[model samples]
Target: MVKDECKTLLDALNKVSACYRHLVICVGGTSDSQNLREELKKTRQKAQVLASANKNKLTTILKDKTISKDDRAEFERLWVLFSTCMEILEIDMRRALDLGQEFPLNVPTKHLIQTGMIGRTSAVAARAISVQNMKYEEGNDIDTIDLNELEQDISEVGEMIFEMEMKVNVLQWTVEAKQEPGTELKSTVSAGASSLGMISVHGDGNKKLCDTNKVFAGAMFSAVLIFAIVLAVCIVKFA
Candidate 1:
C-alpha cells in the first residue's frame, strides 16, 4: 500500500511531464504545458498528503504496545523503506524542477530503484545483484539483516526439488511397466550395442549432438529460473 502511494503518484507526474515535454518541444508549442503544470502541482499535493498518511500509519504501527515483536519489526522495516523512497522522490523532484528535466513516461521500478535501497536486476544497473542497505542500516545503530524470507524460500524450493526428482524417477520406472519387477531399464543400452542398432545409428552423430544440446539447454533454463525466482523474492521482501 505504501509502495502504491509513492509509485502511483510519481508515475502520474512522470507521464504528465513527458506529455507536456513532447507537446512543447516535439509539437513546437507550450499550449499543453500550462495544464500539465497544474496537473503536476495537484499530483505533488496528493503525493504529499498520502505520504503523511503513510507515516501516521507507520507511527501507529510502531507505537502500538500490543503488537508483537515480529510484527513491530516488520512495520519498522516498512517505515524505513517508505521513508527512503519518499526522500528519494522528494530529492528527485527537486532536481528535476531545478534543472527543468523532462521525465520519461516509463515508470520507474516500484521498488524505488533510484534510492538504491533495494536490489535490482542487471538490466537496470551494472551489477547482476546489488545488496541494499535495508532497514536504514546505513544510518541506524542496529544493522541486523533478516534472512527469514530467504530461508523460507529455500525450504519451499527444497520440497519442490524433491517432488520433481521423485516424479522423474517414477517416470523412469513407468517406462518399463510391462517388464518383470526385477528387470532393468537397459533397453536403450542393449539396442545401441546390437549389430542392427549399430548399422542404423552409425551415421546419426548429429542426433546425439542435438540430444546433448537439449539436455544442456534444459539445465541452463532450470538454473536461470531458480536464480530469477530467488532474486525476485529477495527484492520483494527487502523492498
Candidate 2:
C-alpha cells in the first residue's frame, strides 16, 4: 500500500512537471496572448491541486521512519522540483494577468507625452510605465501602481524573452545536482578510508616493535645459558 502511494505521487509529479514544460513553451510566445493566459490559468490550477493533495504525503514520507533512505531522498528531490515549478508558474501567471491587459483603444495625448519622456526599457516596463501614466493622467488614484510592481517590471520582462531565464537557471542547477549525485557521500567514504588507513599503519608499527623486543629477549636468554654452562666447566677443572 505504501509503495503504491509513493508511485502515485511520483506519477503525479511527473505530470505536473510536464504541464510546467508545456506552459513554458506556450508562454514563449508561440501561442496568442489569450491562449497563453488560458494555458497558464489551467496549469496553475493543476499545480495548486497537486500541491494541496500531495503536500501531506510529502511530509509523511519524509517523517516516516519505516521508509528507506533512498525513498526519502527521492521524495525530497521531487518536492524541490515541485516547489520550483510552482514558483515560476506563479511569476508567469502574474506577469500575464497584470501586464497582458489590453490598453484603452483611445490613447490620451497627455499619457503618451509622459511615457515618451521616460527612458528606454523593456516592452513590459514600457507598458507598465504607459499604464501608470494613463492612470495618473486620469486622476485614477485608486488604481495607482505599487512601487514594488513598477520595480519588478523594470527588472524583469516576464512576458517575453526574459520569462524562461529564471526557470532555466533553476532547472540547470537541479540537473547539475542530479548529475553529480552523492558528492558528499563520496567525501564521507574517502574520509572513512583515510581513518582506517591511519589505524592500519599504527597497528603495523606496534607489531614490528613487539617482534623486535621478542628477538632481543631470546638473545639475552641464550647468552645467559651459555655463560652458566662455561662457568660450571671452569669450576670443575679448577677443583
Candidate 3:
C-alpha cells in the first residue's frame, strides 16, 4: 500500500511537471515572460526571507513521526512545484525589463499617469489651487500673502501646463483614430459639418451688414429715379 501511494504521488508530480512545461512553451517569447521573471525574483526573495525566519520549519515537518511516507512524498512534490513556479516567475521578470528597455512605449503610459502619485501637471495644479485657496481664506495681506498661497498659485499655473499636455494627448488620439476606418469617416463628416456651420454664421453676419448698407444707400437711389420720372412727366405735358 505504501508503494502504491508513493507511485501515485510521483504520478501527480509528473502531471504537474507536464502542465508546467506546456505552459512555458505556450508562453514563449510573449510579454508575460518578463512579468513572470520579475514575479519569480520577488517570490524567491520573499521565500528566502521566510526561510531565514523559520529555518527549522522544513526539518520539523519532515521529522514528524506520524506523517505517512505518502504524505511526505506529496509534500516534496508541492515543494518542487513551488520552486519551479518561482524560477519561471523570475525569468519572466528579466524578460519584461529587457523588452521595456527595447520598446519603451510598448506599454501605455496613460494608466501609470492616471494612477501615479506625482509628476502630473493636473495633480500638481490641483494641489497648488487648493493651497492658494486656503491661503486666501486665511486673511493673508497683499504684500505679505502667505507662502502657502504662493505655492498654490504655482500649482494653479500647472493647470495650463496640464491642458497643453492633454491637448498633445488628444492630438495623438485623433491621429490614431483617423487611421481607423470608421472613425476616419466619422471625423471627416464631423469636420465638414463644423466648417459649414462656421461658414453659415459668417455669411449670415455679412448679409445683415450688406442689407444695412443698402438701406442707407436707398434714399440716393430713390431720389435719382423720382427725378427722371418727374422730368419725363413735364416733357409729356408740354408736348
Candidate 4:
C-alpha cells in the first residue's frame, strides 16, 4: 500500500515537470515579443502560486505524525522533483533571455530560444532523477527516515523554487527591453509606424503560449490518470 502511494505521488510529480517543460518550449517558440512577454509573465506567476501550495501540502503530509518511513521517503522524492523542475525552468528562462538578445527579429530568434529551453529542461529532469535515487538510498522504513534529512530536502526545494522565481523576473526585463523604440521610430512618424511589427510580435507570442498550454494540459491529464490508478490500488489494499 505504501509503495502504491509513493508511485502515485512520483507519477504526479513527473507529469507536472513534463508539463512545465512543454510550457517553456511553447513560450520559446513565440514570435510576437509582446505576447511572449505576457505569456512568460503568466507562467511565472502560476509557478509561484503552485510552489507555495505544494510546500504547504508537503508540510501537512509530514506533520501528520503517523506517516510511515516509506511514505516520508516518497514525499521527499516528490519534493526533489518539484524543486528541480522550478530550477530548470529558471535556467531555461535565463537562456531564453540570452537568446532573445541575440535575435531581435522573429524567425531566427525562436530557434535559438527553443534550443536553450530544451537543453535546460533536460538538465532539470536529470537532476530530479538523481535526487530521487539519492533519497532512495536512505532506506525505505518510515522509522528510519530522519527529521534532519527531511528538513534538508525541504530547504533544497525552497531554494530551487526561489531561484526560478528570480530568473522569471529577469526574463520579464528582457521582454520589456524589446518594447523600446528602434530605427523604425526615426524613419517615419506615420500612424502605423511600428504597429505592424508590434502586432506580429504579439501574435507569435500568443501562439507559443497557447501551444505550451495545450502540451501542459495533456501531460497533467496523463498524470492524473496515473494518480487515479495508484489511488485505486491503495484503496483496495488498505480498505
Per-residue lDDT tens digits for candidate 4, residues 149-183, read 32444455557566544433222222222134675
Each candidate's root-mean-square deviation in Å? 30.2, 18.6, 26.2, 32.6
Against the reference, the lDDT scores of all candidates come to: 0.42, 0.49, 0.41, 0.50
Model 2 lDDT tens row, 1-239: 66467557656645654554444443323233333333434444454556545555655565577878676656656656555555564555455444333222133333322222232122322221222322122333212233234335424433322333332223324332444667769979899999999999999999999999999999999999999999999999999
Whole-model alpha-carbon lDDT for candidate 1: 0.42
- Local accuracy of candidate 1 as per-residue lDDT tens digits, 1-239: 64455445444434433332322231111221223333333333444445555555555555568977656555554554554445544543454353223332222334222332222221221121122411122332211111232233334434433443443222222232234654585676676579667776865876888899999999999999999999999999999
On the 0 to 100 scale, the lDDT of residue 237 in model 2 is 100
Worst lDDT run of 10 residues, candidate 3, spans 134-143
Q: Which residue pairs clash within candidate 2?
A: none
Off by over 4 Å in 3: 1-60, 63-66, 106-239
Evaluated with lDDT, which candidate comes out highest?
Answer: 4
lDDT of 2 at 151: 39
lDDT, candidate 3, at 91: 47
